[model samples]
Target: MRALVFPAILVLVMAVIGHVLTLHLVPSVIMGTAMNRLAAQGAALHSFRLAPRTTPQTQLVVRPSPDLAYSICAYHLRGPQPLRIRAAAYDDYGSISFFDARTNNFATIRIEETAPDSSGPDILLRGPAGGEPDGLFDGHDLKSPTPRGLILIRRLAPTQQAYDRVKAIASADVCALSSSAGTISE
Candidate 1:
């Protein structure tokens, strides 16, 4: 009985170790691979690119809905300047979500939550190392836990016409660095 107990304990310890390593390492590996793929597809760091409408043949993400338009940005926030993100509010449904290096969603802004009279919401993204931004800015201030991450913007567009319209609006979306003068500049 004593011998059996020791072996069971050993196996349990090994299982626990494996579980911990998988939990810590898998997310980083997956996220890194995704970032690399996006970079290869001409996704510039700190700049927004309107993704082509999701088709089964070109779908990089899992189970992307055909009824939505997507714009993606792979952001690196290690610089001294903080990133500024702005998206045109859709009439119906739209949202921007920020994900950290580990694929953890740190923030999301939905168009429905914007003020009725506002055109859209302005977001300021800063890394953990970045201090409070200089000057007064009317926007949502978001702090990223990591210096590297991705931003995804989705808008509902059921038809080709709607997709084109969403694309036009998304083209005006800003994912750039904030200048010392407190203005966003690509």
Candidate 2:
């Protein structure tokens, strides 16, 4: 009985250690893999690039969806620069999401949420440490807590025709770093 008790306790300790290690390592591993994939593809910071259509060979991101056209803009806040993303309002459903280096989603906006009369599909992203832009309304901007992150744009494309249309829209999507003169509020 004493021997059995000792072995059981040892097993429990090992399990706990394993669980804690996994908790710490999984997210880092996933984020690192994603960044590596992006680099291999020659993806540049603050530029919108349409992802290749989902295929068996595609492995850049998990769970590639054939029904959705996807684009991504990876950014590094080296200059602590502000980024502006703009897309024309379209009939098809779409969304833009921002993820930090650790894979935390800092912000997301859907097409329906931004009316045609509203900000016109324009969004400003700034570092958390950066001051708010002058004369901009609250909902038009978001702050990223991390220096490095990604902006993902997804559009529903249920058919070949829809795919073509969505692809065009995604291609036209803009992600650019704002000039220093324009980044800060006066």
Candidate 3:
């Protein structure tokens, strides 16, 4: 039994090292692959791409909800301007989520939380190096840990008719530079 002690310790050390490496590196690897795939699929930087209804053959995400429509944007915050994201408000359930390079979801907004009288939830996203814009802007502000990331918007639409309606409503969703972007040069 004593002769097996060294082998056992070696195996345990290797397993622990592998676990630590996977935990630290896997998220970024997955996120990077996703970003590249989205870019290759015509998802331009700073623009919204409305994904088609989820079918087994058309699913891009890990496990997309069959009852929701999706819109995506692969954002690159390297420029001086802050990005503006606006999701059109709807009576049905909807949400917008922001993910950084490490696949960390840093922010999310629900449709019900938006102002009913306005177009929808408008948001300004800045990089870690960016500062708050001057004057007043009519939206929430967020600071991202990384300059490169993704934005995903999901709207509940279980059937064909519901999907069509959700798509139509989501057409108004905007992912672009803020109108006041010039003011925030950093």
How many clashes in each candidate? 0, 0, 0
Cα error, residue 113 of model 2, in Å, equals 3.4
Model 3 spans with C-alpha error above 4 angstroms: 1-18, 179-186
RMSD of each: 2.4, 3.9, 3.2
On residues 82-181, what C-alpha lDDT tens digit does candidate 3 reach at each position? Answer: 8888888888888999999999899999966976877888788988777777566757788888999999988888999999998778778888866464
In candidate 3, what residue range of length 10 has the lowest lDDT sum? 177-186
lDDT of 1 by residue, 88-158 (tens): 77887899999999889999999667876776888889988777876678678899999999999999988
Best by TM-score: 1
User: Candidate 1: misplaced stretches above 4 Å?
Assistant: 1-12, 115-119
Model 3 RMSD to the real structure?
3.2
Q: What is the lDDT of residue 59 in candidate 2?
A: 54
lDDT of each: 0.86, 0.76, 0.84
Lowest lDDT sum, 10 consecutive residues, model 2, at 177-186
Superposition TM-score, candidate 3 onto the true structure: 0.85
All candidates: TM-score? 0.87, 0.79, 0.85
lDDT of 3 at 10: 99
